[model samples]
Target: MPEYIHGGDVYSHAERYGSLPLDLSANINPFGIPERVRQAMHAAVEDCTRYPDPFCRAARQAIGRAEGVPPDWLYCGNGAADVLDRLAAVLHPQNALLTAPTFAEYERTLAGASITFHTLREEEDFALTERLLADLTPEREAVYLCNPNNPTGRTIAPALLDEIVRRCAQNGTWLIVDECFGDFLTDSAQHTLRAQLGTNPRLILLRAYTKMYAVPGVRFGWCMTSNTALIEALYRAGQPWNVSVIAQACAAAAAEETDFARQTALRIAAERQRLRQELSVRGMAVCAGEANFLLFRAQDTALDRKLAAHGVLIRSCANYRGLGAGWYRTAVKTGADSERLLQAIDEIREDG
Candidate 1:
């Protein structure tokens, strides 16, 4: 059987162990769902009898104010993955460029295209350098980048990113940068390409409230681009009721929680540092990442299963491209949860 590409298998863990695991597998918000967002979702239940707004007007307006983009430049989808499906349907790219070990959803969306994986070297700590520019040729029609990438969790350097955008624009390659996890960063502005978005209509910036708001089940994500033509096409291509009423309400309410977002970022930064220090002190090869999660390597063993015995779960990166056994990704959760995961690993190491 094919392995699960993503994480958060609490259901399976419970089925096996007869209880839920401390699921750090999915890199969701450590604080869990916000009360305001929860209330919004609950309140939205009454609106379910009515069909959702096909255009998601109110939600987009709130998102626009939070993201500093005109709602016209934004297009909502069920989730980032659903938006990606729309992208795949719209842009029939025969040749694509993607980095190794980035988000798996990109490859799934860009399937059937001749994909060139620019492998991020482990020696260089999986950083996307200027060398990727060499692959942004005229033949490559599509490119996807995960800022503070999924498992590695490292944001690409700003200058290198700008050069990539320029190269893609020059080659007329469609560029999609997944900044879903950007909100977890303390200075997400520094790493984002939002400044150049006005000049580059072909550049698609995807963001989601799933991670930061801890509403993965809510399925709220949107993409921003200056290309009005592309926007219309994506909207028309997607279902008229692409985003549910609950999701729209969550998006709008979550956008208004600026103070909540700020506090989460500060909390994540502290926990991430603590996790890094603890992992390194335990002799793990922790990557240099500034996101709400850390990817590290331990001595090759059944760490996932071992941790599971202790009712803990972490994302195993064996299936991710350019990575193999012994590599794992764990979310920087709250102090208690983080402590449980570390304690489990320490016990396992000592047992050996």
Candidate 2:
């Protein structure tokens, strides 16, 4: 069997649970695909006979306009993972620093490149501090940071991030910030590093269309960097026509659907707060974060087993570098789905 990545193990969930129930482990939009994006994709299906635009010109232009970056600085990929792998190839850092329990892909991609890695401890709740910044040396070639960090669901303060960026620039270290979940932030622009790309050549920002658009099957994602040289290296290293025609069309439409994006963000924020309140009222200790997911400690491993038995699969963080059996992460799903999970947890507590 293939190893589990992160989040809802679809194959395992289907096999053990009989059928897929509400999958709250993957942090995707609960509302599913938007009508506009679906329509656009369906319309583009007719062009499948022809090859996709290798350059992704139109999609890149749309992304550039939406992100306020030059089109030349953007490069689309099959998914964020593809871009990450390419980054690993081009940067080829000898030593890298990453937050423990952040997205596992950073380490996996770096490991494949034979890169040495250092992990920040979890006692600080995996938060990046000034002392942590001072520990980085010139030998550490690159640093990967996931804002509103995964698994833990915590965010680094903006000022601290600025300081880190400054330090990285001074030491000639590449700072790659994965803002895959940054769209869920109330003030995305304030927290985003895209605007500073030109001024800080050391910074690379990774964005994804999968999570917010609920289009993981389509695999649409891109990376932005002001260094034209790095962008060229990535483009050359990636396969030709990496993104599909349908994915390109759908991702562009989703990016243009400003209203839908705003509504979804608002809905997720409200729903996340509601879920946190409901869980806390039931005696669960939830970790605070800005994304559309919640991380909390279950009373025991029994809760994990019971939830799985009930067909509600959540991410058990035991496999994460710094987490253990009691750690659990669940995405903010629809009102009904969230209620179902809460009810299941309540029942498990009562039974215990």
Candidate 3:
């Protein structure tokens, strides 16, 4: 398996620091899980003895209604990562293209394939631009685009994204755009490619309940594409009941909480701006992002470990390709949680 050491390792931090730390590592919803979703999961415990619907009919139907996609177009997986793994298995592309300093799972899932990196220059603030269209050559059979890209949290402009999609189609490249963090954006619809799935057989869109619903333990995510044959191949790549009954139930309920998602986007917009300004004033090179997290650089390369001592956890982006040490990512938490995070950083290390 690919390295699973990404983040949200509060347990590991607790073990080493001798105390549980507030996790600002994972960009989970600050509002926590919706009450209806929590209750749905609880109500599903009794149904655990029965086999979950292999097709995820009920969950997909509920999610379809919310996401405005047909249930048949959806392919539920253990998580977005799991869907990506199955996708890699089914496509088995000889050559893949992805952005550097984005999600590492793209590299891990396509490990066997020859990979090409389109480095997003830091001087460009890591934002994807028209320059990327040049890399969509015929030689690359598959491509991964992480919207509001991880670590950088910068999204591609719509016109640029359209051109990239057009280029991918011309090259006959299978395009998988990951919009897992789309819910956190104030205008997520602008960044989403859901409307194109019906026309673009080569396009696939991925979404997850992990970050938006704060349900990582459920390991629930789904991908939507109009390519029926590809969807069938994905099912064959994995075993039956890949998603548990509880997870399906949670996904179904969570999909119905549309207002919850809306409020979260609003709150995240405010909180992210607050943190971005604060971090920049503190002498860090903060990337302007609209997501629920901030990616910034610091003089303290060991900042993550140092914060652990003060009962807080943050992600060190040193392992992310195209980035080096001193780069870090922290979730924009609600209320005083962000205050505590800032205070912890102040206590442990000098600002810049």
Q: lDDT per prediction?
A: 0.90, 0.83, 0.89
- Residue pairs in candidate 3 whose N, alpha carbon or C atoms collide under 3 angstroms: none
Would you list the rank order by lDDT, best first? Answer: 1, 3, 2
- Candidate 3 regions exceeding 4 Å error are 1-4, 350-352
Q: Show pairs that collide, candidate 1.
A: none
lDDT of 3 by residue, 1-352 (tens): 5555688988777677677788899988877889999999999999999999999999999999998988989999999999999999999999999999899888888877899899998899989988888889999899999998998889889989998888898888999999999988889889899888888999999999899899998999999999989989989998988999999999999888868888889988888888888888878999987788889999988998888878888899998899999999998888688899888878775544
Top candidate on lDDT is 1
Model 1, position 343: C-alpha lDDT score: 95
| Candidate 2 or 1, higher TM-score | 1
Of 1 and 2, the candidate ranking higher by lDDT:
1
Against the hidden true structure, what lDDT does model 2 obtain?
A: 0.83
TM agreement with the true structure for every prediction: 0.97, 0.95, 0.97
Alpha-carbon RMSD of each model? 1.2, 1.8, 1.5
Q: Model 1, 149-225: lDDT tens per residue?
A: 98899899998998999988998889999999999889888998887889998899999999999998889899999
Q: Where does the lowest 10-residue lDDT sum fall in candidate 1?
A: 1-10
